[model samples]
Target: MDFKNSTENNEKVDANYNVVPLREAMCKTERRLRRKIDIFVVPTVMLMYLMCFIDRANIGNARLAGFEKDLKLKGYDYNTVLSIFYVGYILFEIPATMCCKIMGPGWFLPLATVGFGACSIATAFVKTRAQVCAVRFLLGIFEAGLMPGCAYYLSRWYRRAEYSFRLGIFFSTVPLSGAFGGLIASGILKLPHLGSLKGWQMIFAIEGIITVAIGLLAFVTMTDRPETARWLTEEQKELAINRVKSERLAQAVLLDRIDATKLKRGFTNPITLATSFIFFLGNVTVLGISFFLPTIIRTIYPSRTTIDQQLLTVPPYIVGALLLLLISGLSWRFDHRQAFIILTGPTVFAGYAIFLATINANIRYAAVFLSASTAFALGVMSNAQVAANVTSDSARNIALGTNAIFGYCGALLATWTYLPWDSPKYMLGNGINLACAATWTIVGIGAAAWMVYDNKKRDERQAAGMEEIVGLSQLEIQDLEFRHPAWRWKL
Candidate 1:
């Protein structure tokens, strides 16, 4: 709506179009486009991430269903299976992101889904611990593309202010998948062995088949970007494209050009490092609980059957999913990402602190709820916060890839978290988690302060006319992608 009156004073306009008409059109077009995108992109990606997460996660379920016992896994063998996947996961993330961008998300995402889904299917038939670990590693290679690629893809559709809400919707699937996967596993595990397949085998096969079906459908339903969204009118498309481009311009970022130096700068940025560390710690909490929640529940209710364990897992995850959405929405409505994020650290810390203090199964069970509801939700906010700070697509991708690598490293660490020696009462692991929670809280405070300081400095410099840049080419913007004095980070 901000516009200048032409010399004639009869019309308010800009070079692109008449401001009044454009705003009016955009008001309707953007809302509808968002609705369509919400319906199309969010569910599809959420389902994709759900399947992707469950494929990795179902191993824990499978373990409860006798995956480890049947294979005769000894000592750390099962943990190695969990940890090795992240090795491949860490290696393939950057390449998969590059592939997703090059091939277009619609095509690339589905292909990766199918690849990993097939690996999940292969996991059902593993004859040895070694075979299972190999399948998990290959599964990692395919699964690596999903989260980071989805993050980048979703960002294409909305501005930073609007982004966390959408990302929250997409990421809410993490806990939802756990809940759904629990319900699914509870049902699937009740089945009698069919043609030499155990209940756990059926779980992998059926879940993987569902993922493949979803992936095949993603090509039909998902669009690469708004500019190419066929469901929109050409006018809507133009307006949508310009909207995002304008946001980039306001942040002093280069639009539509890949700056090679962006990769270096994004990875090396102090802010990016701080945020990535936050992301890494967040993932540590996420994977540690996700992979070990059922085990934790089993400790609390030692007499329960596998079915009871599966069913019990549902409520905590369901709560986590709901809280994830609520927090994300509140963060967006208030425009305060950091505040919501810092609170999660205490929730995680309290979960562990309570566990470290008591041997009571009921209190420990309550601790599980605290851990489940906040850790992954915190990770969601962390990713959104990082995205808000990162302005360029390439830079965002690099920062994301770096985060993914660290995230998997957290996954790797998580695999070793609840050791065989620490069973039932994982006091040592809980202590480490408490320490991590404190680190996350402290660093988040520092990061928010840094943003406040930098924003204030930028305002001071701008008032003095000490900083200015406009309409720079990709070449001109080189070496100054996100650090441009005009770029102000979101806190």
Candidate 2:
């Protein structure tokens, strides 16, 4: 009887140990699903954004292709055209976000991309300044939701800890687009057989076609979520969904239903207002440099051919892309986002200041490259950092959209502020960019200080509630008043 009992006990221990293989198998399946999602997610987003950014800024290259001279543009007329793009963009941004929520990214994002592409292609045929402005405005209307939409969509798949690195990869395409745009524009400008159609017109026609094609491809392939993705196994899908929810729940302070009323409340919040203002200031500095940097380079190197001028624009974007990747990686590894922003802000300002003081061709070129690259990193890091700090899903979506709108508003202001009339030595434009950079630095400092103070209060509150056994929702914990100890900001 004793021998029999010992054997049975050993068999039970063996059964318990057998469960380990199942756990290992599940983990492997989850990892495979994650890899599949990333393969689709990273490329789709990066490509879409690349096209969006290229379409918006292609005007810079258009200017070099004799666009201004052909249209008889005078004294900020071109500026007005640039600014009008944002009017349509800002008007449609919020609506686009809502549409994404209703329709899912699989449908809405592609439709928007196609619409903008068609509008961009049509722009090539415009004969007058008014026609150009109208086409750009329409294009902006279609493209308005893309950036925020992608940001929000990706958030659905990734955990908060993973978001910054993914965002950095997605955002890195902006500078890469700048680099690729120069190369493409250079080749198109050299084409001689396109019938009286200028190089700039050809650039638009070809790029728009590519955008439409890519959009069509995305629509057919993009799966909305892991649970709904046909490629994922049942176990894989459950793991993916649960992992994201668990991360969000861990970070959330209050758990409220995300509804229309909550959205309205989010839109009206004071923090949202301050965040929007910061986005506006940062974007002014960003778009100002993007639209005018090439022009400024051309002024300094007036005798160079179109190809040479476009080539000159390369170094800045290259340096900018590298620095952006480095900073984003370090920020994620150390969980120290605010400190990086504070350090990067001055690199941008210094770059602008150097450009303002230089007249020598070599020195001016160096300054422009340094400024452009440094500003690229600063703009990207600041936007992603702020977006990560907000806990409400509705609030985050609206905040992201509002921030983009505000940034474009800055772009609109930049259009007129840095007119062709200013040309070679754009004293006003340079000064404005410098001032904007300085102001953003100050804003970064203030945001960091607020985060620190809020964190302290949260710690105190959590300590006081040690005896409570109640389960608080994420929003409640996230709220400043009901602060939880785990509610500290991620760098």
Using lDDT as the measure, the top candidate is 1
lDDT string for model 1 (1-491, tens) is: 21111222434344565667655654676688778777767888988999999998988888889888889999989889999999999988889887777788888888888888899888889889889988999999999878989988888877676788888988988898888888899999888875788878989998999998989988898888876788878866665565665666333432345567777777887777887788788787788877888888888898999899888988888888898988999887887798887888888888889999898988888888887778878767877877777667777877777777777887888888888899778977788788888899999899888889988888778744323456666555555756676778777
The number of residue pairs in model 2 that clash at the backbone is: 12
Compared to the true structure, candidate 1 yields what TM-score?
A: 0.93
Backbone collision count in every prediction?
0, 12
What is the alpha-carbon lDDT for the whole of candidate 1? 0.81
Q: Per-residue lDDT tens digits of candidate 2, residues 1-491?
A: 12223334555675546756555665576567668778877788888888988888888988888888888887778888898899999899999987776787778888888888888788888889999999988998999889888887787776665666677788887787788888888988888846656678898888899999989988887776666778777866766666665544233322233466446544654445555666677677767767776788788899998789987887788787888788777766775666776666687788778878978888888877666665666655655665565555665677677777777788788887676666677878888888887887787788778877877776777656544525765444444321334546554
TM-score of each: 0.93, 0.88
Report the error of model 2 at residue 317, Å: 1.1
